[model samples]
Target chain A: MKYKAKVFVTLRPSVLDPAGTAVQSALTQMSYNVESVRIGKYVEMVLDATDESEASDRLHQACDQLLANPVIENYRFELVEAL
Target chain B: MKYKAKVFVTLRPSVLDPAGTAVQSALTQMSYNVESVRIGKYVEMVLDATDESEASDRLHQACDQLLANPVIENYRFELVEAL
Candidate 1:
């Protein structure tokens, strides 16, 4: 079976995001009245697996081992059967 | 009122994503059985607005004007009242 995974990788709240800070400052200068901005990465993938459970497990392992840095990031994923 | 917005910026399907390709190749070499990978940006923001409609409008404007590249990327956002 083929499954599609949508993964979100975000910085832990305690971790500072300098890029986000710079963008926020720029927006504020542009008079956007922005309160806060946090930036992260969104990854989508299609993978072959035996079942939904197996696909989910593989996706989680990918996030933990390859996609996300556990020390400064947190990750989450959603999986669905793909065409 | 404070509103939270989750924005997703992705490359149009017709556009090629080199970074995704590199990652996919690496994953395949690692024996992950990955079919395809797409990479994008996710942005979260908290903003002050008069109502849900206003918040939604502001978020859309942000995506259109600054956050996303309309030439090759598409964007979508979700807005919710913030506690």
Candidate 2:
């Protein structure tokens, strides 16, 4: 079976996010009334697995090992069976 | 009311994504059996608006003008009431 995962990797809340801050200020200056903005990486990947549980395990491993930097960033993912 | 929005901006399917290709290859090399990988930007924003409709409108405008490049990228967002 093939599984598709959508992974969202974001900076830890305590960490400084200059890019997010810049976007927030830009939106405010544009009169958008935006209070805050936090930007992160969204990754979509397709992988092979024997079953849903195995797929989930692989996705988590991939995120932890390669996709996210655990020290400064937090990560989460949703997995679904691919057609 | 304050509204929170999670926006995802991705490259069009027809567009070539070298970074994605690199990631896919790297994952496969790591014995992940990954077929494809695509990366994009995920942004979370908090904004003030009178109502849901108004908040939605503002978010759409923000995405169009700043959050995404419509020519080569596609964007979608989910809006929810902020506490």
Candidate 3:
């Protein structure tokens, strides 16, 4: 079976996100009533696997190995069986 | 009321994502059996609003004006009431 994963990589709450701060300031200049902004990554990947467990393992491995920096970022995923 | 919005900005189906391609190739080299990869942005914003409708409107405007390029990307958001 093929599984599709939607992975989200976000900076930890304790980590400082300069990019997000910059964007927030820019948005403020534009008069948007936003108090804070943070940016993260969303990744979609398709993997060939035998079942949900296998796909889940692979997705977690991918996130740990390549998709996120564990020291400062947190990653989560949603997996769905795909046709 | 305080609102938190999680916004997703993604490339349209027709747009090429070169960065995702590079990562896919790298993962393949590391022995991941992946078929496709696409990457996008996840934005978290905190807004001050009286209700959900106002928060939703402000979030959409922010996305359309600065967070996403409508010609080549699509954006969606989920808003939650926050303390």
Q: Which one wins by DockQ: 1 or 3?
A: 3
i-RMSD per candidate, Å? 0.7, 0.6, 0.8
Candidate 1 local lDDT, residue B71? 98
Model 1, range B1-83, lDDT digits (tens) per residue?
99988998999999999999998998888779899999999899999999998888877877888899999999988888899
Clashes of 1: 0
* Per-prediction TM-score to the true structure, in the order listed: 0.97, 0.98, 0.97
TM-score of chain B of 1: 0.97
Off by over 4 Å in 3: none
Instruction: Give the per-residue lDDT digits (tens) of candidate 3, residues B1-83.
Output: 99989999999999999989999999999998999999999999999888999888888888889999999999999999987
TM-score of chain A for the candidates in order shown? 0.96, 0.96, 0.97
- Comparing candidate 1 with candidate 2, which one achieves the higher DockQ? 2
Each model's lDDT comes to: 0.91, 0.94, 0.93
The best candidate by TM-score is: 2
In candidate 3, what are the lDDT values of residues A1-83, reduced to their tens digit?
Answer: 98999999999999999989999999999988788999999998999998999999988999999999999999999999887
Candidate 2 has which clashing residue pairs, if any?
none
Writing each residue's lDDT as its tens digit, candidate 2 over A3-47 gives 889999999999999999999999988999998899999999889
Give me candidate 2's interface root-mean-square deviation: 0.6
Off by over 4 Å in 1: none
Lowest lDDT block of 10, candidate 1 chain A: A25-34
